[model samples]
Target: MQRAWVIQFAGLAAILLLLAFALPRYAQMVPEKIADHVQHHLHEKGMTWAGVRPAPGHSRSVLLNGSAPDAEAQQAAVNDLRSLWYIQQVQDTTTPKIIEPYTLHIQWDGDKLALDGYVSSAEDKAEIAEQIRSEFGNNADLEKLQAGLGAPEYWETLIHTVLLKEIKPLPSASVRMVGHTINFAGKVATTQKAEALSKALRPIEEKDYHLAVNIIPLDIIEPYTLHIQWDGDKLALDGYVSNADTKAKLVEQIKSAFGDNAHLEKLQTGSGTPKHWETLISTVLLEAIKPLQSASVRMVDQTLSFAGKTDTTRQAKALEKALQPFAAKGYATSVNVIALDNAAVVCQREFNRLLTQETIVFSTGGAGIHQESNALLQELADAAIFCAGTTILISGHTDDVGNEEDNFKLSEQRAKAVKGWLFRQGGVPLERMKTSGKGASEPLADNDTEAGRAKNRRIEFVVEGI
Candidate 1:
């Protein structure tokens, strides 16, 4: 009977030893499991910065550490941990993140939209990111934002309104919000669009949001061209000017010069004109072509050209002298001037008499006028002066002594040579004369004899526009 009692007591002692060994280990394992489950629950609730660990001497309780974005977030993390089945209590040791002068910046540089700065919570950040993705597709950068405290009231609403309504519609734009102040800047393709944007943003300013808007309108012009015409009675201005002020100044100058007989033909305002553009146009108008009977001046980018008519060789020479300064300034100038007098029929008769009395001569087989023919050419130029208002056609003839093509070219060169001499020596405008060649086609006598061929190889002057 005593041996049976001793065996039962030994079994009880073995069971007690087993219990003593496993209790501490199982207690340690229970706290670890609870801590792990609480940590996972906090992470799932977007409290990634919150850490969970078992409270000392308390298996069912956890301590939440690390920084939360705000007091509300810290409390939410504690509540999430406490909701776990194995966690009976949660002790939070977290601080709310505080950022002074909280700011949000959005930049859209024509192609890409970038979001930067801070929001109040992850929810707000996610909402802003989703909005950006919806509007900009893959052309957005939203990684710079962080959740924190100190954001202004209704910050999310203000950001959303500015992003989707104002900044999204612009080609290039930016929005910056600091505390209660908002600054919006954008670029538009035209003045109308800029005005529209300003109007659209007026409500934000009126609501006392401390808004400042700077919308710029682009005014770029390519291949700038300006044309001015004067038709004996009235002056006309056409093509592009730089701005309203420039166009107004030009109209005032034109009216002053032409005595109020000026016309405006679709003169537009733009940018991107050459340097000294206004100065060039003004000089050409008031100095170069003012005294002419009829004229047209055209400026294509850096080049300036004009054509006109005057009543005297003196006036033509003066016009050429007036354009010298512009030419010296590296601008291309094409000047054509015609000197026209009203006595056409009388000048024609005088030319016939002069040519019948003497013949103008040139070098053999060349276009150079012979020195001996100077006296005869001087007489012919003197006669041509009276017919300045008419087109004097100088016709040259050659005998059938060479190729027809060669003779034809030679005759034309001789005619031009005569015109050149009249311009250089007698002060006649080159545009007042025309030249032609008749290579043995029109014979005054015949090509069979020397005297006849000499007569055929002569020059004739005919005055037209009588």
Candidate 2:
């Protein structure tokens, strides 16, 4: 009986020892099994990019790693592992998939609606395409939609509520979404429609997303007319432009040229403006009117007429020739720039007649003028004032009464005396008058007789810059 008892004790002790040895191995295997099961679960759920492993030093916990397509997928994986009987805890260490510069572009051009760029998922792509097809008819082109990650929150809401809603009433439009930014451009039939669309887009703008809206109105007016007149002191602008943007650009150009003296009179905006109309108006204002003293440019329909006054025939002819190219390209140009030389010629004749009536008497053999000639000098100045901007030459002549050198000196001094008087009393600029001394070089009758010498010793005035 004692031998049997010893054998039973030894067997029991050996069994206990065997259990102690195998239990540690089984415990280790349990973690491995849990890891395998977790990984299989992830695979069944289509989380191919994810992996799971038993937590170090912890038997019932797992660490999930790798990239998830979105936050929802990562959370779902964690929840799924936690629901398992063997998993006490789940440590999710997964990152969201990255897509840089996530973008979506939509365009509707009267006949066709085209959709392109990235969407968050295949479901999102299908839904967006369906929405576009329903709203814009079957003309939607959705072949370019590609599934990607990194879309902003409520991205589809922006497209459906803001972009599509605002652009639906337009004739032609395009909307682009890149990251948190949205840009919309379109053309509407009236100003009221454009304003309403702009107002509708305000909600998106207020949400701190970068938003840009460009809505153009297509109101048309018949027989577009623009008249610009510069009457020496003030410039008047009366016109009809294609749109507000065109009107702004035109006004800016006018302000740049005419400064604050420009008066805008009933300048309105509408469609039906000729092609390149702004370009033609700018050319006339900037280039053609530069040399004109008083200018008028008129545009009615396709015809552009320019009438101005310049100082010379050369300027008139040059301006007319420059504007001729517009005529060759379907634009009718009527350029009538009158030269002021005819008025200058009439002034010259009047001055010459005044000088012939009574010569300007100076101190004998000196440069000083006599007080008796003041009335005639005043008359000459009044005549010169009428032909403003004309260049006048004040020439001094002397007879053979003195040495040639002395006569030259006297003639120059006399011419200078007359020029100084004109500048001081007549308000004539010194730059406008040129003085010369002919010193008996040019003879009126032959400088031999007393009367001929007196005529030769007189002063002469010539008008130039015609």
Candidate 3:
């Protein structure tokens, strides 16, 4: 019994000796083994493993941070890690934080523009208000009451650029936020302005942000005014018109009514005009005025008034009769007529007016006149003979589309051509006509559009010693 007990003690000692040698090595290998397994699993699932490390002084806990190309791969990596029996707890800090949506709202009343709702910060609200003020002028009142919060930094520049540079001026506008998008509604001054605003906002739409914009034009009851001064040989028109089209129409009427016998100095602005006021001038009153030494006419708010000295009672009667239609349509007219005077000054004045009224149309990019201009050329020749002693000034103009030097040369050639035509065809002496060229200078209309360019390309005539 004593020998059997001694043998059991010896076996227990041998087991203890084996454990003492193996336990230290096992502890050393545990972390390495866990790190290898995790890295291998993430690699198999196309994930990026930053590293795996045991918490210092803690045998079981581990902190992991890694990334994957997609959510599925991330989930697979997490699953593979949790499957290990040795791992106790795993915490992940690699998920992207979800960002909530942001919004801003703005409203305009009378001359005041009010900003409200959420912006990235107070600085952002002030920035937006300043942009509005820059475009809307000093009279516009700007109010800001916005909540300060975080938003994308790029939004500041984007909103300011669109509002200040692209959008048209408005009397009233309102802006509101809807989800991750914006909604703007406003009253624009004109349809053209609204279209311009739409075109400017097109780039913002391409960025995946949704936009809801509504623009309506204000209805202005009182259209712009038209004022004209017609003397026997000289007519000067100055004031506002509806648009380029209206200006062109009025110019045509002036030319037709006086022929090339009157001097015309037209300076008019292009705004939107009243409905049919131009029709009254072209069709009725201007057509009826026979001959006058001096005339002043003001057409405004459906009212017509004229004060002038005519050569005959017949001329006075004609003007009064023609204005009767306007009177019937709630138009009020005051007419003043004086005695007849057919002096040499009137003849010279008529010749000067003719020169201003007529435009010698030419072929494109050449000095040759259009065939349709023959009648106008003949009238010009007759006027030159009527005012034989006066010098006829033939001036040429071109649109701003070419080199300045080239344009100048072209204008000179065009003026010389007209002078030669008048001398040969109209029996006007060469000494009686002087030619000059004004290349793209003194434009009667804007040179931006095709219609305006056409008006710019013209031949003007002026008479001296009238």
Better of 2 and 3 by TM-score: 2
Give the candidate order by descending lDDT. 2, 1, 3
* Candidate 2 lDDT: 0.82
Tell me the deviation in Å of residue 130 in model 3.
20
Clashing pairs in 1: 340-388, 340-389, 341-388, 341-389
Estimate, for each residue in 307-408, the C-alpha lDDT of model 1 and write its tens digit.
667787788788888877767777787775656653566577768888888777788998889898888887678667645567899999999998999999
Clashes of 3: 11
How many backbone clashes does every candidate have? 4, 0, 11
Give the candidate order by descending TM-score.
1, 2, 3
Q: Kindly report which residue stretches of model 2 are placed more than 4 angstroms away from their true locations once superposed.
A: 1-46, 57-61, 75-104, 110-134, 137-157, 189-192, 216-466
Write down the TM-score of every candidate: 0.45, 0.41, 0.31
Best by TM-score: 1
TM-score of 1: 0.45
lDDT of 3 by residue, 125-161 (tens): 6776676767656654445455333455555665677
